[model samples]
Target: MFAQALRDILQPLPPKCDIPQDEQLQEAMNTLEVIVSLLLKEQFDTWRYEALDGILLTVAQRRDADTAFFGGDCILITDQTVSPIEVEVTLGGGGAGLVRVCCRVGEKQDGKLMRHSYDKEHRYRTLIWQERDPHHELEWMYFVERMYDENGR
Candidate 1:
């Protein structure tokens, strides 16, 4: 159980987009750290984000995936058996009453995910304070800049 706490962030940089890491990234990262901290602080009281297993951050720089694919990728967290807590955050803006954030954790495969672990529920929406936080909307954008194209290698 403890082993699942450690996650490997798999991110690749793109060739077409060539630019040094600037203050923008730092600002985003800072915002993300703060937002994540705030979420964890509040969410921990009822749910445990720390025990969410492994986290995967991915960014694609192409539109082959979809029409609205503005080079965005999904952030995934895998469980012990490699079940996915995939959160797809895109550029969203709307009215004050509506909070624009989509968070999804894929269900367990068929019978079980791994061993005795079986996912009872799947797919959800995470309440985010702002879009500038880590693992939020901008986090995906941060990763997209560092993504590698097909010719990157």
Candidate 2:
């Protein structure tokens, strides 16, 4: 169910004619809130989660009049963990046509900055997640474990 929900949320937006880009970006931000709620329910003793709202900016470089940038972070918290994995989302930047989602572990894990992009045409594609993975498993958990292992936890 989690995997399916992630897939649905990450699905590409409709064409600009069918749905305005601003509306599409807003819908994506709303869906991210839902996903964060789901993540909160999956907490265990070793780790918990929190969502920090990102800033909405309307700058001259943006192309759409109604489009304001939206973004946020999902932080994974753990004991003895000074640096947590931050899963971030960005809508409307220089590349206003694509919604960018990235997971940054920390300076220690600089080599593993996972980046995913959602556009209007193609179905969602991610670099690390596989369809055959367990439905209840989230991609972020993999990074959390890696962070722990690398830190000798």
Candidate 3:
């Protein structure tokens, strides 16, 4: 099972990996959710909140040369409450398809930084400046919400 999962993840790219930019952002958000969910389950189960916080810092610091992670922005969480966390991510697009993209990052638990996606789907996340004129193109925007199973102590 592990081997198969690895194979699926390490699978080669398609002949032309052309996709919408919004799709790319959505995929990234989903990926983060699954990863954070699994990691939190493991950490929270073993060491509780302490383990969760410790592992979060550790995980956020991992990245490759192309997909680097950085402390772009952060929020402070103090109160012990059960609620969804919301975040906004703005990335200036480069290369071919899109010139900029934005996405919401935090959820109910926490947020982490990782390698940025270079997929063409980033085009969907681009923001438009229709207010100015037809020749106006602003950065993209996205709204993400992190929902917990319950809202309680």
The number of the candidate with the highest TM-score is 1
lDDT-wise, the better of 2 and 3 is: 2
Q: Estimate TM-scores for all models.
A: 0.26, 0.25, 0.23
lDDT of each residue in 1-153, candidate 3, tens digit only:
221222232233232232122443334544444433444444344213321110111012112211212111122222221121222222212311111111233322224222222233222222211123435322222232223221200
lDDT scores for all predictions?
Answer: 0.26, 0.32, 0.25
Ten-residue segment with the worst summed lDDT in candidate 1? 1-10
Kindly report which residue stretches of model 2 are placed more than 4 angstroms away from their true locations once superposed. Answer: 1-21, 44-153
Alpha-carbon RMSD, candidate 1: 15.9
Question: What lDDT tens digits, residue by residue, belong to model 2 across residues 101-141?
Answer: 33433223344423222222112222122232435433344
Q: How many backbone clashes does candidate 1 have?
A: 7
Ranking the candidates on lDDT from highest down gives: 2, 1, 3
TM-score of 2: 0.25
| Residue-wise C-alpha lDDT for candidate 1, range 4-120, written one tens digit per residue | 110001013333332233453334333433333334444334224423333322321211111011111113233343223322222212211112212333333453322223233
lDDT of 1: 0.26
RMSD of 3: 16.2
**Candidate 3: misplaced stretches above 4 Å?**
1-21, 46-64, 70-153
Work out how many backbone clashes candidate 2 has: 0
Q: Pick the candidate with the highest lDDT.
A: 2
